[model samples]
Target: MKIKRAFIGLSVLCAIMLCSCSRTPGGIAPAGSPNGQASSQLPTATPASGSSDLSQSSRPDASTATSPAKPPALTQESIQIKLKQMTANEKIGQMVLAGIDGTTMNAQTKALIQDYQAGGIIFYKVNLANTRQATELINSLKDTNSRNSTPLWLSLDEEGGRVSRLPDELHKFPTNAVIGQANNEKFSFAAGSTIGLELRAYGLNMDFAPVLDINSNPNNPVIGNRSFGANAKVVSRLGVQTMNGLQSQSIVSVVKHFPGHGDTSIDSHIDLPVVQHDLNRLRSLELVPFAEAIKNKADAVMVAHILLPKIDATNPASFSKTIITGILRKELGFQGLVISDDMTMGAIATNYELGEAAVKAVLAGVDVILVGHEYEKEVKVILALRQAVKDKRISMDQLNTSVTRILTLKSKYGISDQKITEPNVAKLNAEVDKVMKLIQ
Candidate 1:
């Protein structure tokens, strides 16, 4: 698989990054102060909850350089313009994802986060906690970006049902496939609207929602009910409805596992699945919903870790340029974010080294690499990416193209304008009842 000539132009037109020099916020910090400095001496303060008293703490004496310097003023518009001036290498680094936990920040994660300058953060099961715990953890991470005065696109797989990270107390909706089976559009819209509201209220910017994979094979281990139905039209209608409801609340929607993973019996999480179908077969059976989503302006597309012998003999979707740029970008004309499903999983874990996949992924035209769980892994991936650009294995031009897409998603999600806030877990719980009723 080759990065075509057209791919080169993506770097110049959209790829970009920004250098943040302030006390880079959003790394691992304690509940209150990032460095664990005494709360009595907070430099600048933002309330975590609505009822909390909002007031600036007393200023520190000038002699106390230990005091927080004034929070550098950062607005979303300013960051976008600054990113445009960045180098391609920096831009590529910005698109890598380093998974993070709430309670503690590892030095390795911190270093990768600071240096790689990843575009977004995704939370996993291990990373979750109670509302207070989540609020503090995300707040601390957001602080690092705030120090740079750049808002980070904090993301989560709060899809409700089996995949919810934050629990029912924190909000969880019924699975989409469940909702879709109900054959009620109002029920679908309500469920989707609630999911959108809960996500945004938490300061999270994106949802890997409304799974477009049609679940054509009931025996398919990974994507069974994750899809709405066996029929493409039914899935498309529900997926688009879910996408619309989510975007209506300004929460960015990602229709995923793209080019489609519906009929395969193999589970990608355990091993890479190969779909041996021709282009026509894909368009008619699997690509139906994804094609509609691309036309509908879905903000991002999550590349599944499956391999398709028909599309490319060697590379899986994540590392394949043909799947991303050729089919999705060139053929479908999707000009949005391209993020990989977590590279930490066995499918990728069993095949390539983490860093190897990271570098190849960016070069493959993915806007971001999702690496959850290990910080050392994230760092290794980052350093590897940096070295590839240094060694000219992954061109600076290639890196820039992906970065541009990353920033555009951030700008569209409203992350730049809003601070990460505590999500309304209780409200999410109320919707779960509504969703369960419809799905049931």
Candidate 2:
């Protein structure tokens, strides 16, 4: 039973959503902080106290959490419509997701959520070891959202094959490469349909899927068969089918590794890789699926970690405006959420300071930052973001826009409509059958 002490309870869920340095099995505390108060703006994060699986989620003490300000009471629809009218911090909170792993929240994670008002929470493998246990853990996360009257974007990387995090009982669709080998559009649709149908059964709303990478580099260490194909045309055509199938089931799909990870020999999990290809080459091969997916109105776009000399000379795709805003946003016309791949990875981890990257990412136009793996790192990142706003490195208006999109997603998925409850075992098995039939 991995477990850790949560962040201090004094954190208001709204303000706790700030920045922190990286840590595993660590809690987020400010430098020189005593009794949960950071002496200054920059707080040194503390390591989580629990076993690896039990990262600090938020303050476990429910009594100390600050009362919500009168948020002009309105129906769920109005809450969504009124989202645009929220403060910049509120909006930014919607884009930031924290990590949660437990039968229930600990004090520190609760404090972080209640303090910072994070946008969402991501579950790791340790969080899903057993189906019944996972259901309870998810219930705590959902309860946190209900208390705050905010929509929680509870997310998981449940892609089948190598990345499946859900239990064996859940429907596991075939990997993209299997379908790519078939190169059949219907197969692509079937895979996505199966994935989407199964996810909805668990009350999950967002999926980080449909890898747009072309898998051109046979020796690719990170994303081999995870991609659809080696050829851009095949990737683009099948990607469209898969994305359509996902949306048909009402599950929001994100087509990822923008500006591409198709030809990289190195994995971003350890180090940042360079694309080295020219713009024309990128457009013809790597750009096809992304361009097609955006045109199809994909819900979100996950940026890659690699550097592209032809696209941006200064930073990697995650922080490059030339690639994200100039190319992906302006040129391709993608108006949905633009997310950076996990910031705690070696790619971004080795290059920039956590706080620095957090500020720059928002400035560069990414709508969300995925940093759930390392809790201490997440705190430092969030704290740095707050400091950046104070210093005007990141504009308050931009933060608001980011948060607005998150709220819109929450409303669109109707996450608040249903409580996250464990399905009866018999019914759950039937769900697996239903999805299999849809895909088969």
Candidate 3:
């Protein structure tokens, strides 16, 4: 797999450009400030039932020099120009990551790309029947979406253990815990590269892997073995190596469950997990690996649904501008794509309607919202975003910033001059077997 030559031109074009940045409207107020509220200058947003209103949330002070320096703009030619060319529906489509019903390109799949113009497609186990079928399906999705000249991300949650979506015919390696236990950074790099090689062979680009969440809580239901280890230092070191390995093979690595999911006892998929730790505690532990991933220039970071009440009480991190924009974008200074954890998950879906959740996420500074499964709900999200943009509820500046990052990532890793090729199951499995030995 190789980076499309066309994207190299964009690299130079955006070299001098910078990502959109500013203090989120109302920066975080000081401790013991009146009512423990955000600055009065910030716009007030009423939180949903059982949600914290934006004004009531505790946000970081953007003025402090504690935040890292900002990264370069992900695009050139002003993403606004691209936005202007697109219809409101098209722009809305750019924000969605749609899921297909099956491994084949049926009518629903065709409608999603051709009609909906979805910016990306995420595959689950139900969509990977066999090597040939999966390859053809991915190519078909790409071909159909290419009609508009905008590439789509063929993504999957392939974290190499229980999280991997590929069938048994494809290789499956040890979990993150096993890899970390090996204590060899080189092995971790090889594991990530091997996964990338298999994904690339099938024409997929984006991989949501290298779970950056530190396994700090042993009782955590979802992240147990999936995490690298309980040590933040080990996770940071191994996570960066894995990210490098994936990008090295042209597979965009999305370091995930941002701000840390490993410490929570409840799974976000079933219920909202609240991390009671204050910002200082997060910086000391859970946030360490993510900071390292950002420092390594991770291509994308997947924000979790967990709420950090100590930081922002009213909204989950995925729906908080204070967390996404103020902290993730401004404080950490990540210029790469910021994708939301699946919107269909319980933490979000149970609390907010599809349209409401989709709108809030975009407004909160997310680039891509993954509406996995349920086409009806997916359509609702698209229409909601379209309506929001048309009504001016979602600003052009916000849309431009997100679409630029999405397009830049696509331009950088989504494009490929090569055609879909058959994966080497033997070679891939062999690598996994050898790597498994080290961990075993």
Question: Which has the greatest TM-score?
Answer: 3
lDDT per residue for candidate 2 within 280-387, as digits (tens), equals 898888888998887777878888889987778888999888888888889888888888888888998888887788778888999898886666887787878877
Model 2, residue 381: distance off in Å is 1.3
Best-to-worst lDDT order: 3, 2, 1
Predicted model with the maximum lDDT: 3
lDDT of 3 by residue, 1-440 (tens): 01122222333334335323222312111122233311111111111111122121111122211112223323446344444555667767878998879778888878887789788889999899888788777777765664553567788999978898886796588788888888777667767766776776677778999899888889999999999999999999889878876775667899988878988988999889988998889879988899988877787999999989989998899889998998888989988888899999998878777789888989888989899988888888888998888899998778877877776665445242124556656766665676555446
Candidate 1 lowest-lDDT run of ten = 40-49
Off by over 4 Å in 1: 1-81, 84-89, 417-424, 431-440
Worst 10 residues of 2 by lDDT: 1-10
Question: RMSD of each candidate?
Answer: 11.1, 12.9, 15.0
In model 3, residue pairs whose N, Cα or C atoms come closer than 3 Å (at least 3 residues apart or on different chains), thus clashing, are 52-314
Compared with the true structure, all predictions reach lDDT values of: 0.64, 0.65, 0.72
Instruction: Please give me the total number of clashing residue pairs in predicted model 2.
Output: 57
TM-score of each: 0.78, 0.78, 0.81
